[model samples]
Each structure stands twice: as structure tokens, then as C-alpha cells.
Target chain A: MTHNPTIVVGIKQVPDDDEVRIDPDTGRLDRSSAPAVLNSPDRNALEAALGVRDDVGGQVIAMTMGPPPAADVLKEAVAMGCDDGVLISDIAFGGSDTWPTSLTLARTAEYLDADIVVCGEETTDSSTGQVPPGIAAHRGWAQLTYVEELEPLPEANQLAARRDVEGGYERVVADLPVVVAVAFGENEPRPAGLHRKIYAENEFEPVTVDANDLDIDEETVGLEASPTNVGGMETIEGVDRERTVVDDVDELAEAIRSTEVFA
Target chain B: MTDIDPSEYSDVWVFVEDHDGDVMSVSWELLNEAKTLVEETGEELVALVIGEDVDGVVEEAIARGADRVLVADDGVFEPYRADPYGEQFRAMVEERKPSIVLIGGTHTGRDFAGRVAVPTHAGLTADCTEIDVAEDGVLQARRPAFGGNVLATIICEEHRPQMATIRPGVFEAAPPENDRDGEIERVDVVVEEADTLTEVLERSTGETADVTEADRIVAAGGGIDGDLEPIRRLADALGAEIAASRHAVDEGWVDGSRQIGQTGKTVRPELYVAVGISGAVQHLEGMNDSEVVVAINNDPNAPIFDHADYGIVGDLFEVCPELADALEGAEQPEVTL
Candidate 1:
């Protein structure tokens, strides 16, 4: 079961949580006036690295850091069949967080020798689940995190998975150069096959890397060594309930026996 | 030079929890938060409490302010399982060194604090909603991430006894005072059935007797998938407590123990309707610390209307039966536990 195992995942284009656009002069979030996609929990972490490359037989790729219009989510992750794709982007990895965007995805997943990385337990535009455990604590590896289910114990090269505990759920096993983070309902991503969308519009070619290309360390990752200090932004507003817009289910069950909204 | 030196540490443990022998109100809210860091650093707040008859839970953690309880007991530390209560609380934190420990994120503190932080490499934050102590003594903690839309604060700073956990209603419980005064002291954990690596076998019992004490909480989301019959007719017109949202348990529509957020179950009832939830941030990190959040949702920019104390925007199929007929014509308080 180990012929194609190259797997990588990690996508992130963002700003299409149904078309984001709030910049009234820099409250930010204008993502160039909306529409960008490929960030629904990193397309459920690239459908869990294409379901661990369709059950332990791999080759999934898909990577991205952003800019150059985030290479259109790497041509939608090579039309969802990913065999390769990379983009680290320049401007010195802009305002990075989740610790230097996890040290630029751990120096591009240790210059792509990655055996399993997958991510997305957070980031619909910096929702911040802390970059897949800060990219498995800067690639020292062995980080499981919230994943939903992953199997393939490859007779102990390890992979068991499950994880979502707090009030129930946990299995854990890990092993092969780990780091997971999954969980966005773990798997819905698929549509994009049309002959791999015409070989991702001309056999895509990314591979960009920067920050003097990976030999890293410009005073601790970025924004002058991030230790997280975002102390502001407060909008929690919903509490005005008082309505009656109905029609039927027997007047919606006689309007729920008569507006007790749940006594 | 706040680099921690409170005499390099001595005692402050806490973990008591119990369960089959009873006593879990988050073990007196971690002994009312380790009696405020053992009265600002004179240290010695100990509790430990593993189980098996546990002498009425070490005289209820020494009447409820534990200056010392310890216990451990045995019979392979009875039913609390999770590798002999995290190896008898990591053998009383390596023979009582304790500079601070606290554990109460429950489900037996994340199964004995994730197997006692994988053999005490230490630094075990887990749930924490808040926990202070840094004048350089450390342990800041403060969790909530992405689903609660960021609050992080952590700090293990060269780990040792800094641990954290903290979830049941995020702190606020120390006020019993039976003329205060304490000390229980039992401590004999020599349990060697090969240190019981998990084998509770069977204990069942959970058909919703404690959705964190529901007083009324209809909740539903991912826009109530395939008709939960108007959320079971608004939880039978407001007798409430149905709850959902981790997108209606990822669209199966419900049951993941009626999922809520930041990994579920943390309701604070008295009324919390929510129907078509759009309040992500880990479902407003478990009902935005619930108290009275209504939110119906048709998406008037739904972040669960920013924290919903009562938002309606409409369309939960005609405002959940007109808010279940305006809460069946209002007037019905006094339902207490």
C-alpha cells in the first residue's frame, strides 16, 4: 500500500464565506472585494489529503501561502486531483501569524519531503486554529489535533486518527512524519474533475518560496517575531428575538403550541 | 525580574474530581481556584483525591477549601480509569513538588489530562477559559480559538508544574465557608496491577439527564437540515433543551450529544433558542458563555448575530412557530434545577 505516497495538502485562499467585503476604510476584510473560495476548512483539509490519497496509495500535493492572487487556490487544487502544486509567495510572507505562518509551513514542509501534513481545522480568513498546531510545532512533527477520522495504520507506520474530543471522541496513533488538524466535517470536497479541469489550465507550475527562500529566521519568523498580541475587535451582537412569520405544519404545530419558544 | 522563583515551588495541586463516590461540581471549582493561588503564594493548597470510598471524598476536600487532601486510595484506584488516574496523578506530581496544577476540564479532565501530559513533559493547557497567576509565578492559560474567534493566552514557559484545564462555567465557585479550616491527608497510591492501563469495561448512563441542566434551550443549525419537525415543534413549544449546531452535528441534523461547540456541551440555560445558527467560532465557543442568547437567523450577517442576546432576522420556518407562539403567551418563570 505504499506506491504513491507523497501527500501534502495545506490550502488557504479564503474570503468567500459567502462573499466577504467589509473594509469601510480599513476595518479590514476586503480581500480585494470578495469572491475567493478554497478555504472551507482548507476544503476539508483537501478532503483529508484526498482521503489519504484514496486509502494509502498516495500523491496529493496542494500547497499555498498566498499572493499572485493565491494562484487561484492552485487551480482549485489542480482540479481536485492534485499531484502537485506549491506557492509560498513573497513580500516576505506578509503579516504572518500562527507563528510565521508556521515557519512558512515549516520551510515548505521541509522542502517537500513531507509524508503527511494536511491542515484546516481553522482559517476561514484567519479564524486561527493556530496553523495546524503551529505546523506541528515547527515540524518537530507528531501532532494529531481535532481530525475527524483517518484510519490506515499501515501496519504501524501509524495513522489511526479520529480526534475531536472535549465531550467525546479520540483515537490518536500518528507516526509517519505526522501533523494533521483536519475537522471541517472532515470530508465533502470533490467537484473539479473535468479531465482534471483540462490539466489545471495548462499543467500548473507554482513552487515559489521566500524569506531568502527557507533557510529561515529573520528574527523569529515574522512581524518581528510574533507572540500574538491582537488585543481588539469586539462585535458579538444578536439578541432581539420577537417574531411570528409562519404558514403551516399545522400552523407550524400551532406555532409551537403557541410561542413558548421552548419553555 | 519576574522569572518565577516563589522559592522554586512547593505545593498547590488540586485535581480532586471523584465521580462514582460523588463530589464533582468541578471539584469545588478547583478548590475555588486553589484558594486564590494559595492565598497569593504561601503555597500549600493540595487536593489530589483519586478514588474508592475515598473517605467521603476526603471529607469533601476538607470541608471545601482543601489545604491538604491527597487520598489516592486504591483497588486500582476504582472506576475513574485513565491509566490509574494518570498514574496516581503522576505519582503525586513527582512526590509533591507542585508549583501549580489545577485540572478540571472534565471528562475526567481530558482523560487524566491527556495521559498526564504524556509523562509530564508538562505544559498542558487543554480547555482553560481563564486562569491567572502571573506576577512571574506563571500559569496564565486563557484558551478559546478560531471557533470562539481567538483568545489564546497560554504560557508554559519552561514547563514544570504550570498546567491548566479549567472549563465548567469558566470559573466562579468558592463561597461556602463553614468557618473555614482544613486538612485531610491520606496519600497511599501504591497500585500495581501493572498500573491499570484503562479497563473500566462498562458504565453507560447518559440519555440526557444533564444537558448542563437545561431550563430551556432549543438550538438547531446548518439550517435545521431535513425538518426536525420544526425542531420538534420548538422543543414541544418550549419545554426546551434540544440543542445542536456543529452544523446540526455535521448535517446528520443532531446527536453528537446534541453538539454545541469548542468540542460540545457547555450550555448555561434559562433560555437560549438559536435555530438557524450562523454563529460559528466553535459555535460561539459553546453558546457564548450562555445566559439568554436568542438568535433565530436568516443570516443578517450571522456570526450568530455577533453574540445574540436576542436576535431574530426571521425564517426558522416562520420564526420557529412565532417563537413558539411568543413562548406560548409568555409568563412562566420559576423552573429552577
Candidate 2:
């Protein structure tokens, strides 16, 4: 491995989950109800990458695949101390599921000769922590998912991470060039610095790449190639609650005591 | 990508996850769910068990409902590395070509399902809460998206082996029948340690109780103001496990294991007590199945009241301790009885 490894962090712009709403009548998503923001966990991934770069002397590049406005997340990443940003956007890439999404990201990683690829555990909208592993599978690289702590051993060209497993956690060491899915809420992402934010806002322009530039086969890189399809969507109706409002703490306690849960 | 003919697929395979020779309950739950799908599709229900010393797990899987069991017992599979386990599973999938593959949406399942799916060109859906077989034999996988507000039904029309990871606790496990008979076939493990790139160095199990298995839970939220003493007292009085929402966990007021929400564990307890927790849709997704929900919050307009069977508008600091004392006093007669 080179002394100065290149680390690429995958960023995504997702609708604010807290504010997103579903139209009661149409049973469809009202995306306009929520403003777009950088996916929360992705910031943790970028933080992990920035930490690794600081520890081992590497360049952190933020990459995102979305519409044109998606580049804003890259700018946010730059303001957070990333060296560069790449936007892989194209009409063909739209509607691509995790399979093609990861493939396209893998192609971009390879193009940049990234020594490590970092991503969030999952997105808020889809919440499928598959892209990181999918990227590793596409490149046949080792991966660490649900990673809570990351340690870079540049001397050995390996990255060690503590990953969350069912019932427990395990520390795993993988060779450098590993893909890492940083666990949500693992670390507090640092706020963007003032000078960096100014530069990112006023002067920064992410290098844009399309499907054509990545040598992507039109038949294999878009919705036509994506296997999963949304057959239909149904708005979940809220269950009718008894709505028994108790006046005081004692009354609340008596109400709970009267329930079958005590028995 | 190789052209796939969906007609070539036949059986429904459920990947049975093993935790130290004990089969996870979700695997059994998936088996029970798969039985219905197979019944509808006229396909065999197969269980794929991959781990070392999983003979007991294989028998249990058969008794629970599997028509056939495929075993890949190997030392390399003990620690559950994605590369080897995924490679082995991918090999079996390629050779057998099951129509529908159901995996438990555990950390391990989500980690490797894509690894196998991407290589095989199979369509994989993640964390499906509902699944059924379409008339044409396609698997309809429905999952809550955008924080559980809308449920989307997904399908793979052209994929040979449709894949989905079902969230645990969404389905009930069928009672096991020891007398039930099923075919058990051993699969060859071709993956070697040298072929794997990652190595597990250390592991530590959590000491916290599993909230998902708790019959009754007393969970606190951001309104707790970083103090859990009152909630703990209430939980003790109610004899329930203590849990928290994502806000409490993120604020370091509680352990992450005790967090219940979209990104956290899904719990279906019989009784859930929410103290100072505003019910966000994300939080509701995790606890919606609770048989009885009680909310105590200062804000009357808090969304938690909408989902609560009983609501008390008051300060938790004052309400929790008084409720604890009252419940303790009420339980005195039961002890005498």
C-alpha cells in the first residue's frame, strides 16, 4: 500500500425522515413535505474516513450518486474536511437499486484507486445496509459492516474494526482497501469549519461523472437492470387506541393496575 | 449477467442462523412463514443450516417445519464471516436454484445476502415485514419504508431466485413436532481460511437483557432529561425490563442495546410503558405491536398519546415515582394471596 492511501466515503442526500409524510388520501409519499439533507449516518462514515485520513495521512474524497442537487452533500463533506468530491449522476443511474447502485459506486472507487471505501450503515429512506457489502462483493474486497470503532494500521496495510453482531460485538481485521459500513450514532460528526465551509460554498465544484464516463453498460447499470420493483404501496393506518386520559399519576397507576398486564 | 429462467426454480429455502449451536428463533419463525408461501406455490420448504456443530439445529429445523435441510457444518463458518459463509451459500444457491430465499434480517444476514445476491444476479429485498407468493410464483415482499409510514410491496419479475430478508419478531414460530420427518443432506464446504480476507480477533457478548424478549418494558425517551432513576424505579415496580428511545440512547442516558426504534431493535412486548417519549413514527415502528401501551408525558399534544391505550399528561419526575409507589402498594395484596 502507498504511504498516502486514498479513502473514498459514500455520501447520500435523503429526505429528513422526521418530517417526511405520507398523503392520507392517495397513500403515496409526500416527498415535498420534508427537505433534503445529508443522510445522518453518512456523516458518521465521513467522520470515520476523516479520522482515518488524519491518523494515517491520506486524502478523503466524498462521493455521492444522486440527482444534481445531491452534490450538496459532497460540499457538506468538503466543509467537514474532505479534500475533494465526486458526483456520479446520470438519468440512467436513476431508480437503480442497491445492486447497480453499489456497482456504480464500486466503479467510481476503482477509478479513483481508493485504498478504503466508507459508507453509513444504511439510508433513512430505504434502510437497507446492503450497498457497502454489495460494493465489496462487486470488487471482491473484504468488508466490515456495522462497525463501531475503526483503527487504521497503515504499517500492516490493514484496517481493524469492531463490528456489532447479534448478541455481541467482534473485532475484525481486514486488509486495506476494505469497505466499511459505519454504525449509526457511533461517533459525533464534527461540524463544518468556517473557512472550509466558505470555500465549499463559494468556490468548490465537484468533479461530475456519468454512466458513459465509467464505461457502464446501459443495459446493466440502471432501472432496466435493477431487479427489485415496487409492486404497490399502502399507508399503514394507525391503530385505534382507547385514548383513556388519566388525570393524575395515581389514577394512571390505578388504570395500569386494572389491566391484564399485571396478571 | 447470465439469463435466468424463473421456471427452473422450485423450492423455498430459509437460511437458518445459528448462534453457538442454538438456532435463532427468527429462523424458526421464517420457516413457519415459508411453509405458507410454499403451500401457495406448490414448492418444498427447505432449511439451509450453515455453522459448526449444528446437528441439533438441523433436527430442530426439521421438526419446526422444514421439508428438507441442507447442512454446511464447517469450522470456517463458526465465527460467521461473510466471505466464506456467503460463498458456500452462493454455491448451494447456484446448484439448487431455489425459487425464493428467505433470510433473517440479522446483522449477519444483511451483511452476506447482498454478497451472494450481487454475485448471482439475484434480486434481494431487505428487512421485509410481510411476504407472500404471487399467483405467477413471484415473491411479493412488503416492507415499511420512510420510517414505517408507508409499506411498499416489492417484486422481482425476471430474477431466477428471488431473495428477501425478513425482520425478526414479525412472524410467530410454529410449534415443533419431534415426530416430524425430513430429509437432511450435507453440503460440501469448499471455502478455506486462506481464501478469506478478514479475521475475527476478539468477541464480547452484551450483559444487558434482550428487550425484544421482554414481556413488559418501561422505556424512557428524550423527555427524561438524562436521568433514568425514576424510570428504573417504575420498571422495578412493574417488574418489567427497561428500554429507551433513540434519543435517550444517543444522549448516553441509556445503553444502545436498550434503544427501541427504526434503527434499533423491534420489540413486541405485551405491555410497553413510555415515559417522556414523544412517539415518532420511527419509534412507533419498533413498538407498534405491543398489546397495551401507556404513555406519561408532560406535553398533551405529544404523538405518543395517539398510540397509547392510556395517556397521562404530567411531569414524568412526579408521575413515575408516584406510579411506582402506587403499583408497589397494589401488588401487596397479590403477595398475600
Report, in order, each candidate's fnat: 0.02, 0.78
User: Model 1: number of clashes?
Assistant: 29
Off by over 4 Å in 1: A1-118, A122-263, B1-214, B224-244, B248-262, B268-316, B319-323, B326-330, B335-337
- Cα lDDT of model 2 by residue, A21-78, tens digit: 7677987778887989999999899999999988879799999999999999999999
DockQ for each candidate? 0.02, 0.69
Cα shift from native, residue A29, model 2 (Å): 3.3
Could you tell me how far off, in angstroms, the CA of residue A40 lies in candidate 2 after the best superposition? 1.0
Docking class of 1: incorrect
TM-score of chain A of each: 0.30, 0.96
Q: Residue by residue across B1-337, what tens digits does model 2's lDDT show?
A: 4578899988999999876786767789899999999889888999999999999999999999999999999889887888888789878988999999999887788887878888888899998989999889999999888678788999999986899998777788888999999999998998998999899999776664568777889999999999999999999888788999989986868876677877667788878999999999889988998989999999999999999999999989989998898888665323310
Alpha-carbon local distance difference test for all models: 0.66, 0.88
Worst 10 residues of 2 chain A by lDDT: A18-27
lDDT for model 1: 0.66
What ranges in model 2 sit over 4 Å off?
A22-28, B207-210, B251-258, B330-337
